[model samples]
Target: MTFPLLLIPGLNCTERAFVPLLGSLWPLASVTLVNHRRGDSMAAIAGAILAEAPPRFALLGFSMGGYIAFEMLRQAPERVERLCCLATMARPDTAEQAENRRRMIALAEQGRFDQVIGANFPNTVHPDNVDSLELRDLHASMARETGAETYVAQQRAILARPDSRPDLAGIRVPTSVVVGEADMVTGVDGAREIAGGVPGAELTVIAGAGHMVPLEQPDAVGEALAKWLRR
Candidate 1:
């Protein structure tokens, strides 16, 4: 049976983050782009999405969205027909990572939001795409749409997020884990951890891409997701 697909975008991102892959996925099932920017906590965000979501859906969560997906599963596992996590880890924030987020939040609060987004852009994609003006502009535009206040709230939520690694094996849905080979933010190791933890979960590692796998390698991601959907 086919289930409606629910798409969740990452930090400082909107539905635009998944636009590139919609063409390939639209034919597979009904698609819903979720608004994850309304809440400052994962529970709140996931709860809000669940409240407005279809009774059941195939969930695809990108980067920070993956974290929310885990929370959603905790809150309502029966509603998720399948799961796909893209470029995100099942771990909680490390001390260093939390400190880094705090620093970015401080910068955004000080009216240097653009600077914060600009500095983080390079790490989000492959080295080859670092200088691609088109990708850079798209990233910047999405960040702008997300805005500074929401950025801070997202950072806070990310920092406070729980470790989801423990819950991985408990997931019973058809699951797939996708990541970029060169993803420094959430590398193959993280993907492997999730894939290994989840019974019968498949892992797809796209070469020459980074954390922004959906934007950096949409075709490959679409293909991988299509396979997951078919299963």
Candidate 2:
């Protein structure tokens, strides 16, 4: 049977962020691209999406999207048949992280959007992929498509999101925590923390990848998702 799959995009990302994985994974299920740019708080955002989501479906959340996924589980655990947290974390943003987000928000508001991404994008990929023109442009495109207002809203939601560390052990679905071995954004240890927190959660570290593992290693991400889908 084909299951419904809801794919959530990260901060400054739109539907394009999952383009690489679509062809490989779409055939296995009916897929939907969530509009994560709507709300300024995690609760509001999660509630909005949950209202539109299928009764029982698989959820794949990346980066800030993972924060929403956690909120979704908290609100309605049975609705999420399976979970995949990619290049994300369970901890609430630290003061330092929130300040950084505020700085980025300021830059975008000041009409220095590209500059904000220029300053931040390089560190989001593997050291080797940092110089990749395609990768850089893809991210820039996604950010531009997401625009400044949504970016600010996403930052606020991420900033106010609850710490999921205490809620991890309650995840009762088949879960997968994936990260890039070289991911500086979330890191392998964070992936391990999520995996260790939930019962029977599998951890997949894509080699030669960074925070953008879904794009940086589409084949591997596809393979991992395929395996998760089987469960």
Candidate 3:
């Protein structure tokens, strides 16, 4: 029997954040999308997820979801059959990153939430994809569905999340790390770092893609994930 698989989307993301890739990967298993609207801290968020998660499953995380994946491994190692992280890093929020989250939160609270996300649109897509109308519309729709308060809560959880460096070396399950070659927000360097630290992990870099690799290059991301799940 094919066991379940759980997909965790990035910050300010909704189920739609993964629609393109989801269609391609649906045949491999019973896939579930994680919803984390109730938790204010990483532990609380992770706990809430695990509370409703299957007893055993494969875990795939993207960006902020990767951090939550790390937390899940720490919280329930035996339950995860395989793990994959895409366009993600294991580093804890640096002072600069934390401050940026704070500023974003302040802006959201001040009713400049649209502006906050608008400013990030540049960094969110591949430079070439920045002008793509379909991608822009999809991102806008997802942002509206996620809304301001959830974004702020996600930022808070991310800011408090643990550094997963120490946890990486301890990973005993099959692991794969995928990143975009041109990702500036998290960078390929962090993906390399994650691959190096996790035992027997494989790394894949999607060319011409940026921070939103899965959305920017869905077919490639889906193929890579397919390979990861096969092993």
Report the number of the highest-lDDT candidate: 1
The residue-by-residue lDDT of candidate 2 on 66-136, one tens digit each, is: 99999999999989999999999998767777899899989988989889888888879999999999999
Sort by lDDT, best first: what order?
1, 2, 3
Give the TM-scores of the predictions, in the order they appear.
0.98, 0.97, 0.97
lDDT of 3: 0.88
Q: Which candidate is the best by TM-score?
A: 1
Assess the local accuracy of residue 139 in candidate 3 as a C-alpha lDDT between 0 and 100: 78
Candidate 2's TM-score reads 0.97
**Per-residue C-alpha lDDT of model 3 across residues 52-126, encoded as one tens digit per residue:** 999999998888889888998999999999999888999877788789889999999999998887888888888
Better of 1 and 3 by lDDT: 1
Of candidates 3 and 1, the better by TM-score = 1
> Which residue ranges in model 1 land beyond 4 Å of their true spot?
none
Residue-by-residue lDDT tens digits, candidate 1, 110-142: 999999989999999999899999989999999
Q: What is the lDDT of residue 98 in candidate 1?
A: 84
Each prediction's whole-model lDDT (CA): 0.92, 0.90, 0.88
User: Model 2 — which ten-residue stretch has the worst lDDT?
Assistant: 91-100
